[model samples]
Target: MSGAVWDAGRCWRCEADDVPVIWLGPVQTQEHGAGPFAACEPCIRRLEQLVETHHMQADRSA
Candidate 1:
């Protein structure tokens, strides 16, 4: 979807209508265009922390 469409509603995570503080960094690619799915600041930070934690866990297991 286009950036306008992607950002047209509340954050996909927290469902807030505030101005964008950050994004999920393009986890999906639209067939017609490209845009990073947006998320609230708390959601973004939580997602990043989860990713880092998972990576660390994977490294430890490896």
Candidate 2:
């Protein structure tokens, strides 16, 4: 995992390459054209947190 990929497999947030990369494919994976995605553990956590916070805010606003 540490040496997974040097270029595109980095953390989308912190630019880290010392952990396993997880794909963040589109929800509609069967679409005509799908792309690849990668994220490290910490970046994943941060992204999850932001999503949760955003959803909570949306709910409160509604």
Highest-scoring model, lDDT:
2
In order of appearance, the predictions have TM-scores of 0.57, 0.58
Worst 10 residues of 2 by lDDT: 1-10
lDDT of 2 by residue, 1-62 (tens): 34445344666557676666677654335656655667877777778899899999999999
Model 1 lDDT, residue 49, Cα:
91
Query: For candidate 2, what's the RMSD?
Result: 6.7
lDDT for every model?
Answer: 0.66, 0.67
**What would the per-residue lDDT of candidate 1 be over residues 1-62, giving only the tens digit for each residue?**
13522344457677788655455556555575666568766676798799999999999999
Q: Tell me the number of clashing residue pairs for each predicted model.
A: 0, 0
Model 1: pairs clashing at backbone N, Cα or C within 3 Å: none
